[model samples]
Target chain A: LAKTTQPISMDSYEGQEVNITCSHNNIATNDYITWYQQFPSQGPRFIIQGYKTKVTNEVASLFIPADRKSSTLSLPRVSLSDTAVYYCLVGGSGNTPLVFGKGTRLSVIA
Target chain B: DAGVTQSPTHLIKTRGQHVTLRCSPISGHKSVSWYQQVLGQGPQFIFQYYEKEERGRGNFPDRFSARQFPNYSSELNVNALLLGDSALYLCASSLVGGDSNQPQHFGDGTRLSIL
Candidate 1:
């Protein structure tokens, strides 16, 4: 299992692109990077996942460097509704239990 | 198709009491995992069941136990609940249990309050 470090909180204006970076210096070769978003009273939802390079989805984009030690999650044109806690996780396999950090609390202001 | 569903959206329990939380995975999902999220913190894994078998267990105590049914639904049982047990219990289901590419879909979760 690999641990992740991210900012505790961030403030962004609506319509701006917000990029949150996570550091996993000890990431394993087989580990995959995944990002999840959680609202105030709901379970975390999967945002995007990637192994290397960049992967874009309808919700967000994940950028992983060649070293795979860190990744960034980018939310485009963030809106007030995009306010939530974003978590970055590294795991070897699906059956491997997910380990979550405090996460980055993103506050989108209009 | 419906997403993962948890029963009794909210629950209240007293200290030393037992509580059973139910989770119904997505239609074709065969793997169900349980997590506990406390206030101001992220979710902690409790257990994962695949094909009615236990696949993994977290650092939680013995008081936290879970089992999956034949239909892939699961029940998380907690014995001798304490005030610290008050948190949001989440259930996530994935298409397969061993594939990292398959993301887990989560439910809104059941809020358990221990008083």
Candidate 2:
């Protein structure tokens, strides 16, 4: 499994667009990048996923470069309800356990 | 659909005691994985079961055991629970296909408190 690095925390205001980046220096050829949003006292909710380039969904956008060593999760026009920890995971097939680093805590202020 | 469901939502057990936590996988999901999340930390893999067989396990001790039922639902059993086992036990289920990159869906975990 490839280890990941991300910011410990970030601050954003409501209606602002927030982008959090994650790095996996030893990314594998089959690894797919995924982002999950977690709120206090609840299980994580999937946001977006991508193999490379950009994939946009109703919830978020995942941007991956051709090298696939790093990816970014963009949350547009954030609301205070979006304040939560964001996890960036790199995995293949997606059944194996996802090892999480200290996730990036996004505090969306009103 | 119910998604993934676990119970009892909260539990308290004493050291030296045994406890069982149950999880119902999503309809048609064949793989169930368990994770332990300590306070202020990320989830740690404990075990994975697919098709009623043990497929993978993490670094936890033998005191931690799990089994998948015929129905594909599963249970995580901890014998002689230790204080270190006090944490949120999360159960995630995924379909058996390809590598594990399919983004496993999780259930609101069982919060186990060891006294």
- Top lDDT: which candidate number? 1
Q: Write the per-residue lDDT of candidate 1 for residues A1-110, one digit (tens) a residue.
A: 89999999999999999999999999988888989999988989888889999999998999998999999999999999999999999982556678999999999998
Q: Docking quality tier of candidate 1?
A: medium
Model 1 C-alpha lDDT per residue in residues B2-112, reported as the tens digit of each score: 989998799999999999999999999888999999999999999999999999998999999999999999999999999999999999998874444677889999999
Model 2, residue B7: displacement in angstroms?
A: 0.4
Against the hidden true structure, what lDDT does model 2 obtain?
Answer: 0.88
Model 1 iRMSD vs. native:
1.5
TM-scores of all candidate predictions against the true structure? 0.97, 0.96
The models' CA-based lDDT, in order, is 0.92, 0.88
Show where candidate 2 strays beyond 4 Å: B98-101
Q: DockQ of candidate 2?
A: 0.64
Off by over 4 Å in 1: B97-100
Error of 1 at A85 (Å): 0.3
